[model samples]
Target chain A: MKARSFRVLTSLLATLTALGAAAQEEGVLDSAVVRNRLYRPAGHPELSLSVGLPVQTHLTAHYFFDVGLAYNLFDTLAVEARAGYAASRHTGLARSISESFLDRQDKKITDELEDLWQMNFHGVAGVRWAPVYGKLSLVSDIPAHFQAYLWAGGGVGSFKRKSVIQCSHVVDRTAGVCDDRTSLDDRGTAREDFWVHETRVAPVVSGALGFRFFILDKHGVKLEVRDWIFRDSYRVNLLRDDWEAGRETGEKAPSPGLTHLVQFDLGYTFSF
Target chain B: MRTFPRLALLFTALPALALAQVSSGEQPVPAPGPESAIPPEPVSASPQPEPPRAPRERPPPVTPAIQHAPVRAIEASAPAPDAPVAMPTPAPPPASADDTPDLSSEGPRTTDASQQRLVNGAPLYDPNVNVHIVQKKRFADEGHHEVVLYPAVVQLNGKYTNHVGTALHYVYHLQENFGVQLAGQYNWYSDESHFNLELIDKVREQAQAASSLLLQWGVQAGVEVTPLYGKFAFLNNSLAQFSVVLSGGAGLGATRHLIRPAVANEVDGQTFQVPARYGDTGTKFLGSVGGGFRLQFGESYSIRLEVRDLLYTARVDKVDGCSLSDFEAMETARAGNQPFSDLKLSGGCKVEKFDGVDPKTKKNYREDIILGRDLVAEPSSDVLNNVSFYAGFSILF
Candidate 1:
């Protein structure tokens, strides 16, 4: 009777052992399935839309809109192409002086001061490097992925601005007669005013630092600080105060020099 | 002696312990207490085959409990063979599984092929293919013809007035180095108030009054040589084309010297007007040399700035003394074949200079015959040197 009891006990133990083994195997398979779902791969294309506030030093400031297309050459490297419209307004000092000149009774000087400040349209192609990538989990359940990147490029900008000149009454409004007072040269029939408009094309070098936060897998928001270095040769009365002093002494005014611009932007990005 | 027996009992019970473990499972279990030890028996010591049970029979009530107890013990003791290894968790999948792309299968995402490659952290080449590259036009291309028209203000150096004029030029380029051009210009100068009325009246009385300051027109045929051609970036970005052309030519010119009455006189209480007269009108030979630069704005349009120097000689009729009524004396002196005399003054007396005796009259003549003491005269002929500049638009075909 005892022998029979022992056999039954052994058999029951064997059955329980098999059940335990089966449960462990099932757990392993579940873990693997979860891992496969979370894997992320490299190499994707990104598209972005950006709106910027561009400030040109001592020149103008305005809003700009840009659309960019970029491709990931590596896990952390990309090439980007951007085109944008830059709309700008004259600086406060520039505007005030322009308004003052425009209010003058002399139509010639007023016309020259009109539209003296303007914006430019530009294009850029650059390479971006994402050297730092990380994640943040401020909330217990939600996590965020982000990257810090820097970029540099070169491009062309089309700039149009008006040129201004100050003249004396004896020199005539057109100033063409200033040199030869004795000669009766026919300065073209007076248009109600006098001013010369000039357009220029400039080469620009640009650089930027940006932070991108991926709110979703393929979408993100970015904040950027960028600068464009270019030369602008639009003549303005930068030395208007000194020039007015010189004018009182019958001296000629000095000419304007070259300047540059900077911009800050917030944007959205989509990756493919 | 007590220890030896206890060890002996322990050894003897080992077989039963092995049998019980094998029946329960592969999991190890704690050994039973010595106080509960049982003697080794044949059924426990020898490996024995047990009878198979019916497949439908139910397991004993202790079976589930015993099976679970060993399993729980083994789990607490050591990990199972198939248990997951402790490792960091991977990132979660995208919001939507359908949105996750297989990057390897996708086509080239970048617009430029070179962007796929990298050097030093930057793209190997610029991805923007639309960058503007300035292309210079070949000079020897066919159909190089151009026409230009300009309205210019011309000032003749040493002349009192500026000439407002229009100029036209037609050029046919045979080669980059040289071309032929035909040019013409017409100018008109208005009268200016530089001299007083009294001085003008004195000049008019001597028949040398100046009316219009300048009136001239001319046409020229020339060959132009382009000695230099170059390009520079405007605002350091845009390409601008420039060429220097040197030109030389000869042409015919017409000039007129007009005289208008300086003052009106009242004769017999009736105001009489002095009719205007043409003092001289002549056509002369002229030569010009010039140079200019052409700045190209587009494929078909350009701006040209030129400076030219013109040389010509003009003839004027000499007037003697201060009278306009010397016609008879001038004719008699000419018919008599006498040397032309310059009236001079000595001690308030009018004197005329005669060189030798008159052959027809057979009379000796004084060499220094005084006509008047304070006579003033103007010269007859002069050379005019003019430099002009023009700016205009040019069209190329």
Candidate 2:
């Protein structure tokens, strides 16, 4: 199953890269070519970065990261990906549920995310598109590219929530311990599980403004601004129903809402 | 023992507050001028000062019909009371229909006006000096509109009340009373309280978060009126005011979700056997409530905070398809030709009369049903959490 999934992922990436190469071949006036011919090619790929708090509690959200990518598509569009490494912990009600289930003294349930998916490792891949790819010139009446458009795409986003809950005696209402207590399946027993995501399904939509620049003529750079609306399997309920009384994990979120991202994309789209 | 410290703190603070208010230049005197040399009464919980009146050119002498009114005097002396201590004047005979004074209430001698009066207390018309900012928040009331792209059967999670399910809600409030302009609020919730707790017993902790679309069709309207308008605060120029409002309405809702009850059994002692069942269903409930806001946000759009407990319920999937009364016949039929399993019929799941609690029995039984159903609420749908989420806009006239 893993191998088959990997094959599909590889083919998908290759196909996307081919589309980019093919689109560039159309001599669609390479955004890089236009920049080199008209504006001074910039030295660095115009990138936007941000390192801020991951609005949660108890856990120190004091972390920072940058966003941008390395790729070229067009003056209005570019295929790039964003990566950030920050210290964040899973928390909130979701984590709280998992903690409750994990109490060995109470539920005694052991099966958590580690048992369900990541006993060893997990991986992530993404595709970022910066529509309205360009730079901004000061003192120019022309409002930076009259930038606006619709963006719909997907990426991986997942957070963790860890909570500790209290578990006292568990007895059926109006009944004694009729059911035997020992050797219940770990999944069915009282336990806590860490809520983690193997892959976050994110589709994107956006509008942006900026200008394009090229360095050495072959490299296309853009400082684009985008108001991105990410449609992920947005979970409304961070907690799930099936979660055992004390043990629960993973995102039992129902899809409903969307996240907003005001990202600045700066990357060099190699212009052949 | 722990609560004792808190009580002491409050006791100490109350008197200190009165002293502070008295020391402050402004006197929240129940009566104005030297002749009103009365001791300050202890209505000090409220720091609001009575607004100083603009000197009126020699007014006529005091009316013989009413003077030395102890109640008014007490009300005047105690600038701030634990509760409302209005004037002793026989309210100008309710001149209007809307503002008619409800005297049946407040008829008791709560206090005497004469006993309450401060030396510097001055007569003032507008006492609510605090900034009585009446903000109006308006929510776009477009009927419940949403599209569910998910195509999985959502099971019912034993969480939220049966008040909602997979749905949409559009809320609008005219924060004066219980008057809300609802473009629409439709909710679908079923009472699954009797949901096969049996199957759950057999199954392990493995759970699934069902999606749901809950729509609540209700209207809310309330107004925040500064009861004692123009009553000034001593610390800051901002005035102090108490706003009261009453709001209520009714609406129906549609709820739909999946009920995949799982059961677990001992399988050869090594592993447990479990099976997941598919049951998609919906129920409707009528919800209403009256709540007061401690503080309505200040202006056009301020944070409107409130503590309200709304009551609503939904029905769950019924396997018996029979009411409790039907059980009488089923029990008798089972003794002869009918198999016990065959007798299992789904009567619309209803909370038994005994479901709430049995006072005589002093215990909860099957008849005692828990109100409301649960929500996952439907597959791919996330209405709100069990604790739930409710937001709205409020406008006051």
Candidate 3:
């Protein structure tokens, strides 16, 4: 397998080299025209639209769409505002594994794990810097502009936490009776009766590194690796009376600390 | 006895006759000839004469063996070229009057003294020679001056109120490796308790107006060091340039803690009120360290991406709740450079810009502002510890 992959890579490199040679011989990449047509002059504003998929997420798969507006403050600096909607879905496997482990440890868990939840929307304002710029000769005479940039900022996010009771009854079999009369199955006929618990908004911090290939002066494609960090807390719906009584007792629920959601996005941007 | 003797004699005689016949068949005697009597001249020179030919009316069909006989006969009959034989030489083609003189036929000629001197003089230019022409050096001896401005939203730690702000940075490069920078940022605080409705209602019940934390603007002056600068050849012989810049600076900023007076609410025989407030507005000294990469597009424009940590002392007097006198005392102590108990860590990109000048107007083009200031206020403390990242465009003149 390794040898095959190496062979494929070598073949690709050879093809690129051949194409570059042909392009150079033809003089198709006129430097003068490229200089005039490929770069955005100073002090121009740009707008971009992007869609991204979370390559690595804590417990779910997330996909998002973003619209960004940026203003060039200087030759190397820009301020930007980005707003986007992100949707999350549970992989189901993670929940199943967790439930299975819990079931083995304590047989009281008779129900499956709940589906993962996510934030539906977020807003961010940050600065972007194109710190490195260079040209790559992928095709002989034609050069592609390559740029690497990084950005970070803080924003607000609206997230909903939905969970269903994992067990219908957690009773002592020796007593032949269930102790917690208020358990989901003891009172409710359906699972949806005690499914959703709460919805809350939290602060989100994010950072990203973007590599862009400028095919033209005003148009380019960008690949970005981004991470969003935030705090998340939710009810597990495991215990019975203690869970309900803890709220009145001013006891804090168990929290999952900070969660990091990493995503990769490929999109295009047009600069004016 | 006489019969036996006769049989034995016959058998002996028969054996002798058979032996004699075998000898005669094996060796046929040569016919006596006058040629043989002449005594063969030195054996090396004597050729065995061809066997007496048998004349027949029709020639035998030519076989492979007969076909090769003529070649051997011709080789034997041909005379050697150097055997004292004479041959006529062929006449050369008639020379034409227009024929050019052959230089190879001319004998070597000695060079004249002047001619030798001329030959030794400076060589003349030849178009066929591979001459390397050096291109004008690029990115050499250029001025390094740039300015950038950006706006960003900051979250203090992960739980503190969010601040929206803008920052301006100025950099002047003394050499390729070093530069001085001045940067300033202004931020206004916003209410974040709304993220938790329960917290908002509880705070609202205690204070008719929503409580909020406020952070004023700050400025910093620092030195920037660019330790590395490099270029990469992109597609089509295009060059892209970049640099790594590091910086450290110190500055001062202020923060305000505010709360509104309100009536208390009792529910389920328990009193629910907003948490007591800490001391109000005060100023603190701050320090920042950061590094970034700058990618230059052309002579006038570039993009910068940076990460920085802003550090400052936070003074929160938990014992006294929202007391003006206590806040003043803390301010006095801060002015006296008293040691602070809390340290805040905050950094991220505050701004990134890409500027382009309009060709027709020859002026910097501007875009409509898309982000508006957030005015909501919520409960806040004097602590600010956060990290930030920024991207922006810069102009170099």
Q: Which lDDT values do the candidates have, in the order given?
A: 0.43, 0.28, 0.42
TM-score of chain A as modeled in candidate 3 = 0.66
Choose 1 or 3, whichever is better by TM-score. Answer: 3
Stretches of candidate 2 off by over 4 Å are A1-44, A51-64, A70-72, A92-106, A113-272, B1-181, B189-217, B220-397
Once model 3 is optimally superposed onto the true structure by TM-score, how far is the C-alpha of residue A14 displaced, in angstroms?
34
- Best by the DockQ measure: 3
Give the TM-score comparing model 1 with the true structure, all chains together. Answer: 0.30
Clashes of 3: 72
lDDT of 1 at B310: 69
Candidate 1 chain A: worst-modelled 10 consecutive residues by lDDT:
A27-36
lDDT of 3 by residue, B1-397 (tens): 1122223223322322332233231211111111111111122211111221211211322222211221111111111222211112221222211111111211121111111111111100111111101111123213467897654423222222334455689988776556788988876433332222222331111211212334566678888876554333223233334466789998886654433222344545655553322223456687888887565533565555566666666543321122333333333444565432331211220111102433433322111001000111222234354334444556788
User: For model 3, what is the alpha-carbon lDDT of residue B187?
Assistant: 61
TM-score of chain B of 3: 0.40
* Residue A24 accuracy (lDDT) in model 2: 23
Clashing pairs in 1: B345-B372, B345-B373, B350-B370, B350-B371, B350-B372, B351-B369, B351-B370, B351-B371, B352-B369, B352-B370
Error of 3 at B389 (Å): 4.3
**Deviating ranges (above 4 Å) for candidate 3:** A1-224, A227-272, B1-145, B151-159, B188-214, B230-240, B258-280, B297-300, B318-383, B389-391
